[model samples]
Target: MFKKIAILHISLPIDQVYDYLEKRYNSTLYADASEQTKGYMPKIEIREATKNSFLSFYVKGHDPFTGLSVGSWKWSYTLTQEAGGMTKLKIAYEYGLFMSFISGGTVGHQAANEICETALALDALSNAQLAQ
Candidate 1:
């Protein structure tokens, strides 16, 4: 098993950040049609509270780099409210490797980078929307 985690601070409120993630994950637009056709659509769940929230999803698919159906991937997000309406977000990603030849840590790192980049893009978009 391999894991990667990232902590981010977003200018948006906690609720807004949670809502954005919930909607984004629940929407089919966020997934690939080919993956869906392969019955690999991500299954998402959300738990929310007054100041904190958790979102998680799992998807089973082939590794893009090796074209191997090694195992499933789990991604989770934890959001907490902070001072001045800011949101602190934690993104966690885990990939379970079935093949001994594959380097789990390397794959986990690459996937984590991709996940972090996506989250940062989302943050930028959210901030831009607020600025308008």
Candidate 2:
């Protein structure tokens, strides 16, 4: 199992930030039937949500060669309002390998790093939107 956490502070309020994330993940703007029919449909399933405080989801993964289930990426977001009315977001990510042989042992760290990088990108995007 591999895990990583990232913290970000956004200028938006906690509730707004939480809502943005919820909608972003739940959006089906890119939905397609071909992906499902091909047997490699990547998706995020909401596991738990607590108003503006916490949100958890799972990103299903599959092996490219066999098209079999390899494992899933678990992601949790915690939001809080800071003194300056900024929203503090904490992103926790974990990847557990079901078939270790297929991906070797380096996938965990790479996945964790990607998760953190995603958090950074999200922060930048949010800030850019606020600027506009």
Q: For each of the candidates, give the backbone clash count.
A: 0, 0
Candidate 2 wrongly placed segments (more than 4 Å):
28-40, 97-101
Model 2: residue 78 alpha-carbon error in angstroms: 0.8
Q: Write down the TM-score for model 2.
A: 0.75
Candidate 1 runs further than 4 Å off: 28-52, 63-69, 99-106
lDDT of 2 by residue, 1-132 (tens): 767787888877788778877777544543554365554447778899999999988876677787776677787899988987788888887876553445687666766676666576567767886799
Clashing pairs in 1: none
* Model 1: per-residue Cα lDDT over 8-96, one tens digit each: 88888888787777677555565675366644654444433333488777665466566555566677788888998888898888776
Each prediction's TM-score versus the true structure: 0.69, 0.75
